[model samples]
Structures are given as C-alpha cells and as structure tokens.
Target: MLIRFKSPVAADVLMLGDNAQQLLRLVGREGQLKGIFEVDDQPHIIELLDAAVAAEAQAAEAAADAGGKAPARPLVSLRQRVWPLREMLHQAHRERVAVVWGV
Candidate 1:
C-alpha cells in the first residue's frame, strides 16, 4: 500500500530510504505508485497533522457558514487527531507500504 500525498510538500523525504535507487525506480515506473508518494519532503507525521488540522478547520468553518451550529467542542480534538497520522506512518513503515526512505 503506497501513500501518496495530494501536495508536493513531501518530496524531500524520498531521500531517506535505504534503497533510494530501487524506490525511485519503482516510483518512476508506475504512475499508480507515483500517486501514492508525496512529493513534499516533510515528515509524514507533521504533514498529516497539518493536513488534519487544516481539514478540520475547513469543516468547522463550512459548517458555521452553512448556518449549522458550530460544535460546542472541536469535531476532533487535537490529541485525538495526532495519533492516527503517526500510527499510519508506523504501519506504513512496518508494512513496507512505499519503501519509505524519508521520515
């Protein structure tokens, strides 16, 4: 299972794999593989957290704009949101999801 980011903020991470050459070769050969890899170099954890925060904020704002009552609490608290991203990275690593070289 490859993990691709919609943004290119993660390209720097491509350098961290022990098999960079093979990973790059695989990534280059398959368009589907390319879609799973993030071009952004940032750590997946940070990027994921940032994305989640942004998404949550957008959702909250949209709900407010639609005249729906903003939640008395955040839709997902910061703590609740942080772990999944890290867990995903860990799972991806353990599963060899993308031959991840970068953190």
Candidate 2:
C-alpha cells in the first residue's frame, strides 16, 4: 500500500509500504498511520530521524571500510528515501500543521 503524508506547508509525499514503515519507525511513528504531531513531539521526531539516518550511514560506512575478499552486501541507505518525510515533518513543525498518511 502507498502512504501519503500531507502537510499544508509542503508538497505531499507518498511512500510505499516498506519505505513508509521505515519513516514511521525512524520518526518514532511506527504505530501512527494518521495523526497530528504533538508540539513537543515534532522536534523529538526530527531528532530521532536524524539519529537513525546517521546510524545507518555509519553502519554502511563501516561495512565499506571492511575491505576484504568478503563483499559487503549493498544496503539501501536512508538518506535519499527519508528526505521527503524529514522535510515534511520539518515543514509540519514549522507551520504548526498536521501530517496524515493514508487517504
């Protein structure tokens, strides 16, 4: 299924099942499908997403650093995938708007 995150301050962002779940988890919204972010949760969600992205990048870098005969499995890094959600969340917070996924 595709999830659409809508906010008044930015363009709508659509994500597929896996990608949507990834964003939900990164922003600590795994259980959320549609809802408004609490004022206090906006910054916190952004922080969590940032940390998750950084951690994934670090892990990918570590795997790359382990240069040897064993080829490292290619992983889909979050940088590109999460950009829209991150931006949406930032805009949501800035505009004091709500973001909803689905319908």
**TM-score, cand. 2:** 0.80
Off by over 4 Å in 2: 68-76
Off by over 4 Å in 1: 1-42, 74-76, 79-103
lDDT of 1 by residue, 1-103 (tens): 3333322222223221223333334224322333343323225544545665677678878989999898777554654634443444444555445423322
Candidate 2 lDDT over residue span 13-41, tens digit each = 98887788877877666866666666557
TM-score of each: 0.34, 0.80
Worst 10 residues of 2 by lDDT: 68-77
**lDDT of prediction 1:** 0.44
Prediction-by-prediction clash tally = 15, 0
Best by TM-score: 2
The whole-model lDDT of each prediction reads 0.44, 0.76
